[model samples]
Target chain A: MARQQRGIRTRRTILEAAGAVFDEHGYAATTIAMVLERAEVTKGALYFHFPSKESLARAVLAERPPLETVPVRPCKLQEMVDVTFVLACRLLDDPLLKGGVRLAVDQCAPQSVDHAGLFRRWADHLTWLLRQAREQGELLPSVDPRETVEMLVGSLAGIQLMSRALTERADLAHRVAVMWSHVLPSIAVPGLLPRIDAASDRGSRVTEDLG
Target chain B: MARQQRGIRTRRTILEAAGAVFDEHGYAATTIAMVLERAEVTKGALYFHFPSKESLARAVLAERPPLETVPVRPCKLQEMVDVTFVLACRLLDDPLLKGGVRLAVDQCAPQSVDHAGLFRRWADHLTWLLRQAREQGELLPSVDPRETVEMLVGSLAGIQLMSRALTERADLAHRVAVMWSHVLPSIAVPGLLPRIDAASDRGSRVTEDLG
Candidate 1:
């Protein structure tokens, strides 16, 4: 068990180092030697966990940290906002998330892996939340959950990308709040509007609460 | 003057070929030789027009085709929708626009050129249109034109990208129309909402009318 734990720790360290390198240089420009150097691990050790750069990228892409951290809330709409906010906050600091998003959207490395899976997961989660919101009478009757899910996913992706391009995502949480402000009015029922906190600070608050 | 015109035509041909190649293989994988093969131009001819691959990518990034084509409409809101629709249609078939967007968003080639110019131009134009809409009493008094412009530009980019990734942008017009449908209700005045045509077919109709 001790040996297994050590192996896990070493694997995690490699993944984190790889994430940072991938975030900086992107997929094609990134190399295993860079990851090994950053990780300060022997080539054999690094290869034991991740055999190739593609697998490392796939591992980085598969890291969905924010999803595991968001605590459930009574108001589904609030939970949805919290999810986006928390993700935005994580994206700001987490190399893994940043690298994953870059790899997923960057058209340079199409053969790496199925980047669409991340988007599909996000859409599915948002759809489930929207269904819950609809059941709770938080959403307007005219809202199509699926369409709204796509818009939410797509718009957030764009906002994050633009923010990253312009400011390296420094104001991502704020931009996401602005996006929700523009979007909520069109989809949320009037009764729920005042209750849902879509503030820029919500992410920090949620992060603290989760901690 | 005739020699200069011929030079311009050759440059245009090289740019078009470069755009198609960049759209397919992205900036990193693309080569001058691939472009030469695609354009069927000699090394001397290609070099005479574009100094390097970076210059060709920059030229493709600098290509602003949609702005020149969208005619002014009496209703500013209609014109805004028309701009997006026309852009969506053009994006469906135009390699220049596709490659430009790809290069603009791909962070892999950060040192190549500043690709944010295209996004800024789009936002500036949208803001101008929103201002006109405000003056004509077509927009909600509460709407912030700048914020809406960013959202419009960012969301459209995201939508087009998602469409491209999922379906090779086959349904970009429909997706863009859906975007406007969601956005128009929040920004447009109630009276103008019914008049604004955000239909999928509006792109083809507007394209024909413009021609």
Candidate 2:
């Protein structure tokens, strides 16, 4: 049991080091040796987990922000906001997901990397949440869940990209907070606006609640 | 004078070829040899023009969509929509600007690429147009030009990225047309919405009119 647990921890450490290196040097420039140096693991151990740099990058790309950690909400609108907040907060420090997002948008990635899968899966998740919001009478009448998904997904992506370029995503949570202020007025029920918590710090609060 | 014109044309051809190569292979993977193969130019000539791959990429990043081709409009709101359509239309075929957009979003680029400059310049342009719209009484009383610029710039970028990932940007003009439909309602004066020329093909029409 201890051996298995140690193996799991080693795997996570390698992934973390890969994310940090990818974030700093990009997927093409990052080397296995760099990851090994940061991770302080033997190359044989590294190869035991990931066979190639491409596989390592693909694995990092798959490490999406932890969306499932949030407790389910009755108000689905609040649930959606919490999802955004939590992801933004996580992005501030979690090199894995942050680097994943960078790699997803990176046009330099090899043809084999499944960049579109991330965006599509995110759309699927957001689509489900928005649908629930609409069913509960929380969404505006003109709101099409698909259209909302496109706008929300695209805008959030752009906002984060811009934030990263401008501030190294230092103010991502705040920019996302600003995005919600613009978007909610157009989509959410006016009466419920006051109750929704789209605050920049909602992510930390939710994490604290979970912790 | 004829020799000067020919030199200018060769420079343009070289830039075009570089953009196409960069679009396909990305900055890190692209080689001057591949550009020479695509450009059918002598190595001496290519070297005389762009000294390095980094310089070539930077030049492409600087080759923004030709916003000046658009005629100034009486309604800055129409101008803004036209700008979006023109860019969307051009993105369908212009390898240079499309490649520039790709490079700008690519996180794998080396540190000297200056990706943020493109976004910042675009914002400056949009801010000027939106300020004009507000001055001409075409903007909503509640709309802040800076806020609108941030939303428009980021959302347009995101929409284009998503459209590219999904359809190779075949539907970008149409998607941008849809974007204006969503955004204009929240910012434009209600009376001016009817007059805005935000159709999907407005880009082609405006281009043909100029031609």
Candidate 3:
């Protein structure tokens, strides 16, 4: 049991090291040797875990959706907003998630990497939450959950890409707050706005509960 | 004079071929040899026009903002809408523009490529039109132009990226139309949407006028 725990710990170390290197240099420029150096692991150990650069990248990009792990909220609409805010907050500190995001949007990745599939998964997650919002009477009658999904998912991707350029994602939560401020009027039912926390610092506030 | 004309045409051909390859293989995977084969130009001719791969990519991405050559419209907001439509339309047919956009979003591009700068230029262009829209009273009183710019520019990029994944951009103009359907009510003054052509075919109609 102790040996198994050490193996798992070593695996986590290698994954984190790979994420940092991929984030700094992107996928095409990254190599297994660099990850080995970053992890300070024996070549045998690194090879035992991630045999190829492609596998390493795939592992990094395969983070489970935050909604699956985070506690469910009373309000589905607020939950959707929280999901984005949580991601925005995490993006600032979590190199692993940030690297996955960069890979998801990366055009320069090899043809075998299904970055498009990542976007599809995100749509599915948001779509499920949005349907719940509609059933709860949290959303406006005019909102089509699928359309809302595309706009919300894609716009968030764009906003993060833009924020990364403008502020290295330091202000991502604030930008998301700004987006929610504008978007809620169109998607949320009237009088629901007052209950929603679209504040820039909402991420920090919500994440504290998770810990 | 004939020799100079031929030189110009050759330069255009090389650029087109490079754009197609870059769009197909992305910036990192593309090779100058592939471009030369696609262009059917001698090594000497290719070298004369472009000194390096970096210059070739910069040229492809450096399409002058279309607003410079396209006719100005009577309504600034409509003009802004048309800009996005025209781009969506062009992206389907113009490999060069498509390649440039792919590069602009490409994380695997070399550090020197300045993909971030492309997003900045987009913000500047949108900012110019949005201020005009506000001055013309086309925008709502509550709208902040800069904030609106970030949302519009980033959302459009996200929409395009999603459309590419979903349908290879075949449905991009329609997606943009749907986005406008949702967004216009929030940003535009009451009674203005009736005048703006946010239809999916707006791209074809607007570009026909340009041609």
Candidate 4:
């Protein structure tokens, strides 16, 4: 039992170090030597733990605990969108996720092995959340929950990347949420959209310059 | 005059070669030596043309010709959307823009230069188109043209990245146009929406899977 716990700790340390190095230097520029230096682990120990550099990166990319395990409230679709945006902000706000987000964006090449799986998983998570909203009758029946999820997730990630590059603002998560709410009504079932119409109207004037 | 034209030709060759190298190897991985090799120019010619590696990269990144220099007609809001999407497809489809688009997405820590200028120009172009649409009473008076433009450009770019990463289909341009037509109505002036309502309704079911 003790041996297993030690192995887990060592693996976590290497993954964290890899995320930082990859974020700073990009995937191609990052080297195994840098990983060893950052983790402060000996060469033998690093290899014993992660067989290769790619393996180490895959671990870093997949390190987050499953979203299913994350505590979620049974909020309606609009509230869920609001909450999900908040959580996305909270995740990016974390120093750990910042490096990973940077690394993911940096390595998102067509040829890179990382792009397909990471984006698909992200889409899947969004779809799952939207599916829940649909079952609760929050999303419009005319809207396909899966497709809506894709657009929402894809737009949010793109905006996040652009905002981070442009502003270096840590408050990007909040900004993303604000932008998202405006388009949210269009996807909600017609009757439900009016429920939040008052709140949306108040802030509609504030984001006139976002482009 | 002949010598100046020759110099211009050489510069074009180098710039095109640099874009190709950056596309294949990404920004960090690409080097001037590779650009020189691809352009088949001597080191002296390369240096004389571009003072440094970063300078060459800046040239490659700078000044994409405007996709739409003039409207074909008066540019109705729906036609503007269609024309602009067609232009986007052509740019993204081109070998030159393909790599640039990848760079735009994967580039994490931009050089502390005026890189935001690129996106700013894109936003400007989109905003101009939307303003024309609004003047024609196609878009809602309540719509903030700037934010709407950002969402449109950002969403299209995001969708392209996702499509490139997942499907490898060269037809993403066509796909996005179909998708955007659905999104257009949601932001159009309330009564103007029904103008395209019939067309959008037909598409709603067609694009259900991937919209």
TM-scores, each model vs. reference: 0.97, 0.94, 0.94, 0.82
lDDT of 4 by residue, A11-70 (tens): 778887887787667667778999999999889889998887677667666656234433
**Per-residue lDDT for A92-182 in model 2, tens only?**
8888987787777766667687877777778888889999899999998988898778878877888888888888888888878877766
Clashing pairs in 2: none
lDDT of 4 at B196: 51
Clash-forming residue pairs, model 4: none
Best by lDDT: 1
Over B92-127, each residue of candidate 2 has an lDDT whose tens digit, in order, gives 888898778777777677769897777778888889
Candidate 2 vs candidate 3: the DockQ winner is 3
Per prediction, fnat is 0.55, 0.48, 0.58, 0.31
**TM-score for chain B considered on its own, for each of the candidates:** 0.96, 0.94, 0.94, 0.79
Q: Which ten residues in a row have the lowest lDDT in candidate 1 chain A?
A: A104-113
CAPRI class assigned to model 1: medium
Question: What are the chain A TM-scores for all the models, listed individually?
Answer: 0.96, 0.94, 0.95, 0.78
Which candidate wins on TM-score? Answer: 1
The first chain of model 1 has a TM-score of 0.96
Per-candidate interface DockQ score = 0.70, 0.57, 0.63, 0.38
Per-residue error (Å), model 2, residue A54: 1.7
Off by over 4 Å in 4: A69-76, A79-83, A108-112, A169-171, A194-211, B70-76, B108-113, B178-182, B194-211
